[model samples]
Target: MARHEDRDPLNEEDLAQIADLPKVELHLHHEGAAPPAFIRGLAKEKSVNLSGVFREDGSYAYRDFVHFLSVYEAATQVLQTPRDYARLTTALLEECAANGVIYCETFLSPDFCGGGDLGAWREYLHAIREAADAAERDLGVTLRGVVTCIRHFGPEKSRPAARCAAETAGDWIVGFGMGGDENRGELNQFLYAFDMAREAGLKLTTHAGEWRGPSEVRSAVEDLRVARIGHGVRAIEDLALVDLLAETGVVLEVCPGSNVTLGVYPNLAKHPIAELRDRGVKVTVSTDDPPFFHTNMRREYFNLANAFQWDADVLRELTRNAADAAFCDDDTREKILKRLET
Candidate 1:
């Protein structure tokens, strides 16, 4: 990690410039990014009770990581139809655009979309894509999906989700991944599902090493053979694994705010994102679940600048890293790179 004393501290103007830089976010959750007000309005219209889901001030509330999952699910209960998801895409993209995100790849779960049914998943996907298209035209932010299966749902459930991803593998749905409670299952258990997605030509990523240790990241790389690992900061605990990640050109979707909010690290200053980058690991910044963490792309950039004293050059490098790691096709990648240059 770059030490504070090793570089000149950024002034307020430099921080402002860093925050305004165009960003590419490779790790985001679809439902988890729902703004609290949107969810509240949906719940009101649907007559769903979301008593414990939000705090008095209207932010999502939870006692711990496990409880947060339950709260997240409760909040998502009202978004039952494809139309609801379309509205969500619009709201989320507006936020991303406000934060100067030019390109984003979000994790979309078949489980939440339609209970892992391919036919139903397709309906939900179409609605989302339509909204995404509008958002791209109106908000100047591009969106793509990575079909993700909840890890705690078990390997059997993941099969149907993977099948959905394979069936819909195309320009819009470009990747397949796993996200959920890391403690509940081993990475190797999802091997069959990953292989299925790979056969369909979808890129791969999996959440690992956030709650667990370096071995989990190793398993994600070796057993699952993922090109990216979400929140792989724990790999810093094992230097050899870190070196391996750098050598193999694997990307780490490091969500500093989420990690800090969830107590994965005490604070951003202590986070391993800079260290991972400095060690040659391909690290990128993102707000995994922005609303849940009370963060966005702008806040992430500003905090990282203060924590690491990273200037505009380093921040732009991270954006380039995210662009290189994005699962979009070449044409879209070229467009995003062009936007960044401006």
Candidate 2:
């Protein structure tokens, strides 16, 4: 990563231009992106107690990554019905639009939606899609879903989640992925589920190299055959593996804020996103769970600008990278690309 002393600081005008630059984000977590206020409101309406999920200031509170998962799931408890998810879709998109995100693909776990039941997953999907469609029209921000399986839930549970993903594979639900506790299970253990998704024509991506080493990212590519790896920044530890990722065009959905907030790195200066991009790897910026990290797309651009001295042009290229890597169909991809150009 570039040092702060290496380049001139951005002025207010430069910062404003960078902030207004349209963005494309591909690694967002649907439930994880919920606004604290929205979650609290829903919890009240449902009469569900989410006492420890938030801090005194009302932000999601947790000590570590493992604890964050618990808090995230706890906040999700109030989103029990399809109607609740619909509201969530609108709320998150409004947040995205405010941050200048023109296109975003969020991870939606079937386990969270309906406990991996195929029939019930459809109801949740329909409700979310209806809300997404309305958001596109009203907010001008496109939303798509990537059905994810929770790794800690084990591979047997992944089977039903994969079934739900395969059943819903279409224009909106464009990909199948696994997220959660990358430390819990090996990537190969989920191969059967990944294979099922692939057979149904869903794109693949997996959470790897976040808590693990380069070997885990290698497994995600060689074993799961994913075209993208979520938080694959740790691949930087092995120069050879980094070269391989660049050569194979496996895009890294790098979330700098999430990494720093979760203590993956001490700070952005120690992060490897700039190095990975410099080495010819396809890298895109995103907020894995924005509010949890107290970040938004605009803030991501600003921090990267300050950390690496990135200007509007550099930020635009990163947004373009996300557009190219997105799981959306060709038509939607073109639309996003055209928006980026403007």
Best by TM-score: 1
TM-score per candidate: 0.98, 0.97
Q: Compared with the true structure, what per-residue lDDT tens digits does model 1 show for residues 217-311?
A: 99999999999999999999999999999999999999999999999999888898888888899999999999999999999998898898898
Q: In candidate 1, what residue range of length 10 has the lowest lDDT sum?
A: 1-10
- Which 10-residue window of candidate 2 scores lowest in summed lDDT? 1-10
What lDDT does candidate 2 reach at residue 157?
A: 95
The runs of at least 3 residues in candidate 2 whose Cα sits more than 4 Å from the true structure, single-residue gaps closed, are: 1-7
Residue 150 of model 2 has an lDDT of 95
Q: Candidate 1 — what's its lDDT?
A: 0.94
